[model samples]
Target: MPMNRIQFQPGLSMPEFFEQYGSESRCEAALERARWPEGFRCPCCGTWAHCVLRGANRKMFQCNACRHQTWLIAGTIFQGTKLGLTIWFLAIYLISQAKTGLSALALKRHLGVSYPTAWLIHHKLMHAMAAREERYVLSGQVQVDDAYLGGERGGGKAGRGSENKVPFVAAVSLSDEGHPLRVKLSPVPGFTLKAIAVWASTNLAVGSTVCSDGLACFSAVTEAGCVHQPTVVAGRKPKE
Candidate 1:
């Protein structure tokens, strides 16, 4: 798609074009502005350094105190990036400006780069979303379930209960008003008493009422100290 067709609304924009146009130069400039809002100083000696950029080293700022020149982008995440300032800025713009997230494939097409590069950039960004990654103890009228993530392994009786599966426990907490709050997930090697206890103890807070299936494993784990309210699910029937 053409650059002009990709419209940006400063804060509220679409996903695809957002990734295509975010420029790294813009990002670097902003970084510089934010880092040195008052003025540029020699990072090494902390002096109100030279006015002239000096020589052909565009990235370095000259220091008058010790005459030491250091890279402006040093220690920042952008220091080692190989892409141009414009391209990097455009990539950042595309990712941040978009309301709904852009897929890696869409970003690859827009950025004219390899699939791996686009995927890496997107994943790297997703890693930084800390607020979205918070873990909470789901309490008060909750539903807990076990899910198998990854793949099953081994064969037959040898693998009966030891299928080398990555099992995950999940809990969804509801507010007093019954609005959903948050869910917690944890993966384990086996669905044992020890495993269940660990998962629950870490994710569920003490004294927070819990509702779960009436299983021996859950029984043993619940004794690890939280107050548990059991609901048995047999065949297709659920008995509270």
Candidate 2:
């Protein structure tokens, strides 16, 4: 079967955006609303503090019990980041909509932030994605396979021809009841028994029935207590 890829178009004009929220006070109000959607709750005392004005009559609130004064942009991803609110919104919009992943340089130009700052923010967002996705586990019937992702070889005599290739083993689990082999790929140093054993132990459960083409490294699977079914080819016939 053939596969299709997706492309995204640019989105939103600044004037169209500002026409919705054009002023400093308007922007601040929007930030306050987003940061405190449940109204003002005192961070110190955890009570719903009364909304009060800050310097120049700003829209910040003073904590009722502890009198701990704070703004809406406190203690979140936006906290302590000095980039303008408009740029922050644009940065978020661009990254969320991007499919091939955005470069720090791209984000810098798109959001008008320094290169170093953009890199920092981009890495921070990537960390956030991993943290969020780490909660889910792959379960049920799984597919075990090795994909050679070798790269140009390097280091000593081991870095010779076929160096451009690396070994990757993965186990993709069936979705719902259908077996689609949704494995997680990990780079194996080589097709060595030690490498395969470590990868299998980490990626497969003790009860999983793994299928392979009789690779020696996979012998450890049986030793590890899982049933291994090796597909066989003998002479002109097959052995069950």
Candidate 3:
């Protein structure tokens, strides 16, 4: 038997995050290093030699060869932002480093920002995350379950037709021993064959086996080049 070389590491806490990215200048330098590791090259023209101009707020990078000017946060998510770099870093830490994740209202209170600002930041960050997730494919044996999220609307309809039920599919990839490896919870318009096919195409890997309850729409995974195994629940039940 061999030990798994993969190791799980914990995320940075608030104190640790502050120690590393505590000030705006530190955040700016870190972002610059991450974006242009070799050196600052002019976006307009490919030149390495550049000078820094201290503006009212941000520092502009001027290429000596091409005379093109650019800022540290230009062309990035932080572009044309009134918020400070430290605040943006804090928001990223809270949204990503948290174990259970944080809500927009909670982020608003934690960052001391207004509701609209917190909501906007959270929305953009989450949208970016989902866009990134679209590039990944779930491999190996996958267990999939159909589900509906959201609570019932007060004094409104109930059951599947309830106004509050947002249909979704929860799929989890399993290791060789049947342990859950990774999970994907995606919202779909409905549990129809078309929706399931679309979800399978986007999320599941080709030739992977999908296990699910005996649902007709589960067959749609075959259209995505995956094998489907439907399970039947045998029990004594009386229809009321």
Query: lDDT per prediction?
Result: 0.65, 0.66, 0.86
**TM-scores vs. true structure, each candidate:** 0.53, 0.55, 0.77
lDDT of 1 by residue, 2-41 (tens): 5653254244454543453355444556667867898788
Query: Could you arrange the candidates by TM-score from highest to lowest?
Result: 3, 2, 1
Worst 10 residues of 3 by lDDT: 231-240
Question: Which 10-residue window in model 2 sums to the lowest lDDT?
Answer: 1-10
Model 3 per-residue lDDT tens digits across residues 92-199: 888986668899999999999999999988888888788777777888999998888896568777766567899889999999998878889999988789999999
Alpha carbon lDDT at 61, candidate 3: 94
Off by over 4 Å in 2: 1-40, 50-61, 140-144, 148-174, 177-240
Per-residue lDDT, model 2, residue 75, is 64
Q: Candidate 2: lDDT of 40? A: 76
How close to the true structure is residue 23 of candidate 1, measured as C-alpha lDDT?
Answer: 52
Query: What's model 3's lDDT at 128?
Result: 79
lDDT of 2 by residue, 88-181 (tens): 6666667876768899999988777789999988887777766654454334556666667654445634431246667677667776666464
lDDT of 1 at 212: 71
